[model samples]
Target: MEGDGWRDIKVVRNPYFSLRIVPTVVPMRYLELAQLYQRLEKTTLKTLKTRLVADFLKKVPNDLLEIIPYLILGDVFPEWDERELGVGEKLLIRAVSMATGVDAKEIENSVKETGDLGESVALAIKKRKQRSFFSQPLTIKRVYDTLVKVAEISGEGSQDKKLKYLANLFMDAEPIEAKYLARTILGIMRTGVAEGILRDAIAEAFHVKVELVERAYMLTSDFGFVTKVAKLEGNEGLAKVTIQVGKPIKPMLAQQAASIKDALLEMGGEAEFEIKYDGARVQVHKDGDRIIVYSRRLENVTRSIPEVVERLKRAIKAEKAIVEGELVAVGEDGRPLPFQYVLRRFRRKYNIEEMIEKIPLELNLFDVLYVGGKALIDEPFIERRKTLEGIIEADGWIKVAENLITKSVEEAESFYRKALGMGHEGLMAKRLDSVYEPGNRGKKWLKIKPTMENLDLVIIGAEWGEGRRAHVFGSFILGAYDPHTGEFVEVGKVGSGFTDEDLIEFTKMLKRLITKEEGKRVWFEPKVVIEVTYQEIQKSPKYRSGFALRFPRYVALRDDKGPEDADTIERIAQLYELQERMKGKKIA
Candidate 1:
């Protein structure tokens, strides 16, 4: 046992390797969680996923219940917490190599082969050359706390320190645990377990209704805390977790609609049509003088746009309120600029004043979730919109979104055209009687945007589809030809608009063209062409092309076209310029 890297705790001076591993306080072993992750990954059934999680949560001690949900969701903190591991794939490979005494190049090759960093790390840990004697079995609390410490590390020598901590954890983790650990840290734990499934699990574990759990999650934006309260105090405790003024509520999302006529029919004819500005989705929370701004992903972005903060503080009449809106960047002509301009402001950290000068933003307030001491989320949208309008005096910087209450499709269509002519993306149709359902894409709201131009792009890569399309390719990574460089540059990924027959045909076609495989991504020879229709072209560094298509959907396979004949980057630039020129122009 001495030479085999196993240590007896009695003989070891520091048994847990600098970790405050309190044996008595340990509630659930990480091995158990890892086992659950395996089971979840093996199946795609929602019911099975719910049963597995519910059964696991039922066995969790109340004291450790809070972190369980977060861990299962592949995060140590909630989305609104503003903290992240910040460790990239390179750092992870280095950490895994350091722990397992494997060559870094070998680890890289393994990742390339599997297309999954977690799976590669897991395999490395299983075949490690050396291990520490005092390696302790990981607990849920221990793993969560250690990961938080890793994320919180910053400044000089933080990378080395993070690597050390991660290596230590890897030493203690079993192969399966290491697999899930890497996935969790990388924020790619695709175990087919969604938050909706987790909500159901929490409800099942506590013997409460799923609606209660979802309501609690919507108001709090924290499923972990929701699970704990439900486990301890049941429904009564859950009911207490209501909307807070300064805390961001998950903004209610809308489903896409084919047209205004269909949207009106879906909402019983009578509906409220509001201009859907092509900008950032913002949720503004105000308590006294403090105003917090959150993005659509629930990331705290208060510091990015101070102008919006000042405007909210000055305009909001109530002492405490929560409002939702679209933040658009406008040019000197007082016309809305492209969404990309606003995104630049959103991403700007330093040189805020310069960015503000470069791009002035206007907040088009729409829905109010809280006012004074009352929670308006459960209230009707009509009432909420009224409260929003009543609480804020319309100003240049902040104003309620231009809305018209209509029962006719023709009226809605006219309004939508006017909005589009005014440079907005489209219109949002809302049921007047529907309540504000935070974090849900319920039938209460429908988004209507007219069809835009389609691009025939080359298939550069594809990912293995999940659930029902598990055997076929579900999503595709498309690229445009860079005429200058003679290279294909990625623009966006599309997973929608494919028929079952298309999926089968495309899967077979792409599989045959696979140049290489890595994780879920399969690099193709770029010989295939596909037609894609998108809402708008925006400047984004997220893709290699330095541009991305918003809501890009597949139109059809361009068998008539080849990769060499695909759209060029020049065309994308021209389209973007055309869109910009159309803005602030009179639509005669």
Candidate 2:
């Protein structure tokens, strides 16, 4: 019993180091973070949680503060980094089973009861059949290093290596630490500490303004870097953060308008309207001759679209710039296909050239954020548009999106009809004086489609299929993101709109995400984003979001989006209210 307590508090020297790093240390126990997790779980007040994290950060040693931010986020690297633990649930269960000397069957049973692998690990440790007298207390440095090592492991028997590393952490952890350690490795940190909260915490901890911290985060898209910057250089360093060529920024989002006339009115009786193509949003960054393309979600997609790279390499006239556009999938007749066709090309890791030949793309440049070593986010939209138009040497494969500047509703409506006739979605309206804002959704920009009411929802739970549809998930329980709580709450479920081919691909993709199953009902980890259409919105007691979609139909799988980018519960409320006002009017 004394050894057990000793193993929870005593210092253990970390055996991991890189040849490049100078061996910076935190001088804290991993138990500190686990304790913070416990405290965060005990409260639902966001202010309290933010204050707790701010206090914890204020006490940290500055030598290696970067790792702590990512750790608290349950990630080994920054959000833009491609590295992940890549460890699935079964591998985690095996690691827990191996560490506690608990049988695999019993651990599985525990998972069934708890519905959380982390909790299962905590419970299994109590009945341990193995013990080590020489085991030392785990340090924050060791735990962080070990999981990062797990992420870096690849090629040939990597699962065995990942299992061994995780098991070692478990052997050294106390029960509470074991619970969080598992969850962190699985990338399911349930602390409700969203990036927004952490951003606020960094500001509070360092006595810097929240806006400065937010600007730095928006420019770099890396909270780890922001934390270290705030610690080392304070407010001055944070204010100086600028856009880099390779790192991706979170793209700006838009709101929806009822009609072209309404869009014109919202923009003060005049607006810049451009065709909104039915394609994935693509961000292009260039430095010298090198160029990188990113998807809407800031995913590095250079390898996925080789021809786009070639086209961009020769199309842009500037030596350094960051531009954005729509990369539409085009058919043999040169008509644009749906956005999923572009997503299919982006997701392919093998036979990419063949897929490119099968589905071609057209890049229509729209906005420019950076050029000549200066960020243009502060520039007015009209100026940015002029800059974008001047730099791009347009060709058939790559060109600027068609636009019309007008204050007349008749012209805007004609332009909208022309866009639809040209096989595009509709038109996007932007205020001439609006500045480009990253990761923001407001009235600065608006989307006006013929019927633009689709919602991007994440699948939270589902039911198994029946009869001929028995091979795949028959119905999916969908939820909208709640930014306030950092949770996805149920809004509706859809059992229709899936093609036979969709079922086959969905079965292959979703079987790996099964957390726990009960008869025909299965719960998922909220990874899959899908576009959905509904007849109307209704106040309902059946869903946690307090609203449900009427006759919801699945549109497409948004493989390009993550769960965080899904429509928010607030947005659903707005849409519901909008529908109520249009009760008598016929909606397209």
Candidate 3:
């Protein structure tokens, strides 16, 4: 290839995502991944997406296996690794301007039309002024190494160095390559190659069982290493993967059940109803005297919440163990504080002890994944609870969640009421025989929140206000994801709950993310997430999402969540069915 394009890879197109047939002499190139990304983006069939990744993996050389998966996932490092490029958006814009020789204002104009920074950069690279007639081929390894350097840069003039490095990189990248580079650097590949797809892909590429690959991925939380192990060591090696003490595994997720009776019925008449605390979900790892804590997203937040670490260090009976629990920030009155307060404590880099004194955390242990040098994930829920009961002697600061084991709906309702009376969110009804499956939402565990639980929705489009509100957005269109297609569909519009302060703050926050404007209504790239409370979920033709939220009201701006983290169309339908049931309607 001529110009500043990547080289040395042969391509084979497959109906499903697949490995390209590369000659032994030609090492894998970044172009191959870029092409795969393009193909993955074109098709909405998730099965094709899985095959595309599998095919890509089949052609990956053993040495590049570990690095390529991370690139494909758009993560420079493993999921548990905390390193980031540290380059800000303004700096990125400068880098783009320098690489393309396009005016910064012109690039911003392109963003308005293209609706995506990556796409605008790709368009800009078409007009790159410093293009070379013949340049060294860009390789995945070079890009990965360069990005690692960017992440490693720190303190005093680091921004300048990062900007220079990024500019040079974008200058070297071809139009298509630059598009993906922009997205990769921003950690928004948008390739629809979620970890689940890659897990299945690895299983198919290596002929190992999908369950084996999933277990390995779940335990390690790194597909690059899992792919490497699957490719080099096969199933035997994958089976060897186990949860380690310093590494944080993805926490098991619960399904949302509309009612307590429904959850108990799913759990074979008897279940464990534990109070669901309104707080952050945390995973604690104890190895000897040191303890590390991780959030629900596998973020390493040990330093942010020191009290949890010290408390766990002294509370655990075993030297090596991993447990999952909720860390609720309680107020001086002993009532649980809002999630925002605990979030601040979890995010503080300095004055952590000061924040701890102001917002004390109470740990309510629920499940144990590992203990006494043994992994208990394969054990039944009851056995794991029994093991957890034996592993920790609760001081007041740390205690197992209060729970009730009963088969009667009346008893379950009473337990739930007691929990709600205590100002908790609700109760978690768990199947006694269910085994813990990491990063999965299944009937094994069901969440029962009273009445209608709030929905986390993404803002798809917004309308500017009139008169006094003309300076800010007045109404916002909400959207939910369709996991199968990876598309966002409109569910409702919210305008009622914002204060004047909220309107000003939200308008400022969303202006930069605007994609296109049609009169007073402006479209967005689905970046901002807001929690919405609604009276009911009703079937409607007003939105393509097939369901809509009735009388929706804005709750809070969920800065912690992204579009993917928002609710799904499937959830909307589930809630709709639940509402119908509550109205005493019978299904055919």
Candidate 4:
């Protein structure tokens, strides 16, 4: 047992690399990170968690520090990057089963017992009867490199190859290490160490202010790069991080308002109101002749919308700029379609050209953040609007979002109603003196939508949460009643706008009504009623209801209402028709 303990702590020399590579001689073992994971798992206090990660990061060598942030996030690449491991739960289970000589049935049973596949694999590996003698001990770099190779594997027998790489890692990983290795692969490393916590940890570890770390992260959208900058050049190096053409920055966000009058009041009795077009938020980055489009999540979607790329190339007169807009799909009559049509086009990976022709899009330019190597994020809204208007030559398909500058509350309300009448989602009210703040949901910007359109839906099911929400069900499966059939049909899932206390309370309520369990999803009897608000009603075939809700958010528990009192499919249909008629009248 003493010899085995020493072996577990021992840093084995790698047979894969030559002795000439100095770093290979002192390879950073995976045990260090595994130990950190164990500590973080046990350390529930936020301050203690941050301290553990900060100390752990400080111990990592500078060369390996670059990937540490990504590793901490349970990812190899930044969120903005397009690389995916493509390893599903079943594939991972197969790999684990193969590596440990555990029965596939035993693994499936373990998964059923434990809500998480990571925990299941760990249990299985701990009880495994066979072990490989020739396997090399895992290292942090080796694990990351193998996953990247798995992500790069494609075309014919890719699953087999991915499984093989995962098996290789499992064969060498100790039981504790295998637990986190599985979680990392599944992208559910639930140590409660999110990006924000990691940001604070990075600041503390490098002795820089949290603001500088945040700014560097905002500009680059890559924690790996931010960590590298923090380690090498300190605060001065972080200040050098600027808006570049190819890298996409996080889009600024807004808080929803109850009323336009309230929104205007929040903006000091005056605000710039723009029609909130019901479409995907897009950020266009132009460098020389190259045009790239990024989604709100900072995903590169340029290839998905070729027509938008071409239109933007001709619409913008700037040499280099980063502009934000909404890409709304248009009907054959040139009227903007519902947000779902645009979303479908955005999601398309194959036959994209066909979809582009079938569903034409109109770019609605709204804000400018960067131009001519200068970041306008610090500029006031009025100045940025001026700069945006000055540079863009609006064409029919690439026009600026319609706006109304108003100081009076009545005018703001009227403009908001007009925007909703025009089939827009809502009105975005911005303070005239506010600067463009990326990744912030401050009071500088407010989204005003009618709250009278709330729906009382039944909770039919729920899925287990991850990270900070690991113990409770974070999102609830919502359903609308089909009165004709007397059955509940799923409309969508609601995961946002719930407080931690609410989640805990609801989780206890859901546990009592659970009728069946399938993986992380727990199907409950339709007893709990909740009020929900959504941006739009979209036609979708993904749900049995034949409809879906866009951006669904929790309002409050409708304790006064029963499942029978829940909103029906008929009501949903009526809302959809009413929405269409409102848009039609505006078009006419």
lDDT of candidates 1 onward, in order? 0.81, 0.85, 0.83, 0.81
Better of 2 and 4 by TM-score: 2
- Against the true structure, candidate 3 reaches a TM-score of 0.84
Q: Whole-model lDDT, candidate 2? A: 0.85
Ranking of predictions according to TM-score: 2, 3, 4, 1
Clashes of each: 4, 0, 7, 0
In candidate 3, what residue range of length 10 has the lowest lDDT sum?
1-10
- Candidate 2 lDDT over residue span 1-588, tens digit each: 121222223334556943342333335789998999889868768899899999988866664477888777666777556677898878888988888889888888887677777888889877777778888888888898898899999999999999999988888889999988888877776676777778989999999889999988888888878898997799999989988888888889998887787788889988999999999998899998898898887778888898999989899999999999999999988889988899999889889989989999999999999999889998999999999999999988989889999999999889999999999999999999999999889988999887747999999888878998887888899999887676789998898899888877876676545666888988776778999998888999887789998999999999788877889999998888767656646642
Please tell me which model should have the higher lDDT, number 1 or number 2. Answer: 2
Local accuracy of candidate 4 as per-residue lDDT tens digits, 227-321: 87887789999988888788888777676665677678889988899998877788999998899888776777888898889888988899999
Q: By lDDT, rank the candidates, best first.
A: 2, 3, 4, 1
Residue 408, candidate 3: C-alpha displacement in angstroms: 5.4
- Clash pairs, model 2 backbone: none
Off by over 4 Å in 1: 1-26, 254-272, 405-417, 429-432, 439-588
> C-alpha displacement of 241 in model 3, angstroms?
4.1
| Deviation (Å) of 263 in candidate 2 | 1.8
RMSD of every candidate to native, in Å, equals 12.6, 6.3, 6.5, 11.9
Judging by lDDT against the true structure, name the best candidate.
2
Report the error of model 3 at residue 81, Å: 2.2
The 10-residue segment of model 1 with minimum total lDDT is 1-10
Best by TM-score: 2
